[model samples]
Target: MTPMIPMIPTSTTIPLLDAMLADPARAQAPLGDGPARARTGVAVASFIDGLRCFDAGPTAMIARVEALAPEAQLFAWEGVGLAAEARGQIDVALAAAPTFAPLLLVGAGWADALRGRKIGAPRCAHVDRWSVLDGQGFCLGLLDRRAALLEFAPEPTVALAIDQGIGRSLYFVHGGTASAIERAIMDVPASRRGALWSGVGLASVITNGLNDTARADLRERGGADLQLGEHLAALLLARISTPPHEPPTGWAATVLDGSEPPIAVLRRGLDRG
Candidate 1:
């Protein structure tokens, strides 16, 4: 069994948590009910914690992040990358290497490419670093939807990553209205929508508790690719040290019945020495 991730210590995390809790609306994502609400809140807090704790050093940051619930630590790691980039401390974190392998793994997997440029390895068993770009896309979509929606870009990989991020933010930022989210997606360039759909799949199953009608509508709009996205996110949840908070009424209920993902697979890509 995965160990429990305790609440972060007060010196570094409490103020950050309090500030984030106070401004929950700033991100515009509704805090739903039950497991989904709690999990979503945890991700936000962990992200905020990541931003706050980074200055203390990677070792300090890792200790605090590990204190969070195991299922939500990935976002905390993502926050650390955001903090490192904002502070120009990328190299500092990367050099920590095997000692900070978990953060490096998530950072490489779920961070933006600018950060990836600094980290030579992802430290994953089978995971790739593509989602790092997707993380940037989420920020753009949530903070600047116009730019995110209108990217006909030179690099398809980066463009798709942005598209996926926008799709993810759309699920949270838009009111839980399927038609509105669907329309926003449909309004974007067609080639980009698939990536967006994948991000939506990530949000729906990963956080859970999107209303049934809205969830069904989005899935219908997504067509064949939606399930692919959902399954991948489910598999990712399996990689967490703990079970994801996916609920029966939520979209991932059916897929999670099989098996937990093997996170140890991540170690094969790294050299502890």
Candidate 2:
């Protein structure tokens, strides 16, 4: 059995996020962010608010994300937003999607396969041009060496197609309408949502809410990656569901809550059944 990994201290990750939020250069960034960029920005900000550290609200954080959109890759922005916001939206998106869209989180090895033409380039290219929440064809983009690919279609067919693929992947069969996916993401719980945003693999660390054991387990099952950190700065400022200015205590408070790092207390409070 694998020995459980200790939880990463907030101290190790908080400063990195703090610096991203404070950089003055992000102030005058995105000149004319389109819908995809705007939605991606909102998703990014929602995760930041879930962190409970920086006080920037959706309005301000969205503006900031828009400014930075031009300087950064769109997937770099979307990946972060999805990492933090997927948790809130996943259940609902799955429920609301008209067809199941398989969202694939690929590893560096798989990305290389695509670039080298080892595996055929996605049949549907530049899927990112369509919203993961609304598009019909797959949205393909890089998260570092990894690639996040999505195709809205029947789950059984998509799953079978992927199962026969040349590389490894972790995926979700999301169902629901495009608008539903968007709305559900907006409804994600503010505090613990940080924890839920923890994606399936190495990228899980980007949120700093899940312990190593959980992340590792996810990796073993082919569910995570390393690209989650791309939006750490924006996620820190995403909106919170808790009442304004009232810091949550107990497990209600996540490590992202810099004002009150309550995971320890919350963990201690849970009955060790």
Candidate 3:
């Protein structure tokens, strides 16, 4: 069984939010087209407001901490309110404090937020793109800074300081126990330390899939261990091939089934090394 990790009290939420909003560079990292990006920002802002209203105790703590940071901008996306309009459009909520960068994204509805857009999982795909772009992403800094990601899907929630000058990303997967997600985030890999940010993103996607039982059977049968490197490799492999509708029987099956050839190749390389 995976070991338990400490839970981040809701109190830290607001301060983290403030940090993300403070940095325009991080906040405006071109996600998609101009209108789409605007909408994304709104969705994030709205989520933050919702969090404040929904959980007062944590919001108070976050507010107090945020008072110490630099100023930031907050926005929210309410969406079109049509059932059919909800599919791929993301609903984002945001908040900003005076200490760190502005908190760009508080809550995200992956399905409704980016309606009809196949963005995959933002955290996972974002990290992969970063890796492909520069052979690294800001994940290493996030790990060093002790940041994490939190999700509560059907609506995925991410809490972290993006523009505090300390680059880090944190995320939680849908249906996962908060404690487990925290533990996984803190257990960043040692070898590919530079890829910590991307790893967190990848981990979220895998865990999200697993939580939904979409990939549970495969994980169990594949004999797959939830190590960061292995998970990243597996996700890359799955993305390139026909990801199993559900988890495969075992690691061998997952790798051999052509669902994850990249993982298979990585395993071979590791064996040789």
Q: Which candidate leads the pack in lDDT?
A: 1
Candidate 1 local lDDT, 164-190, one digit each (tens): 666777776664445667778888767
lDDT of 2 by residue, 63-165 (tens): 4444553323222333333322222222232222212112212211122222332233232232321122111111221111123332212233232222212
Candidate 3's residue-wise lDDT over 215-250, tens digit each? Answer: 343233223223333454464444333233344343
Cα deviation of 28 in candidate 3 (Å)?
5.3
Which residue runs does candidate 3 get wrong by more than 4 Å?
1-50, 54-190, 194-273
Residue 240, candidate 1: alpha-carbon lDDT: 48
Descending-lDDT candidate ranking: 1, 3, 2
Q: How accurate is candidate 2 locally (lDDT)?
A: 0.27
Candidate 1, after superposition: displacement of residue 159 in Å? 2.5
Which RMSD does model 2 reach against the true structure? 19.4
- How far residue 136's Cα lies from its native spot in candidate 2, in Å, is 8.2
**Model 1 weakest 10-residue run by lDDT:** 261-270
Worst 10 residues of 3 by lDDT: 76-85
Model 2, residue 5: what's the lDDT?
Answer: 20
Error of 2 at 108 (Å): 24
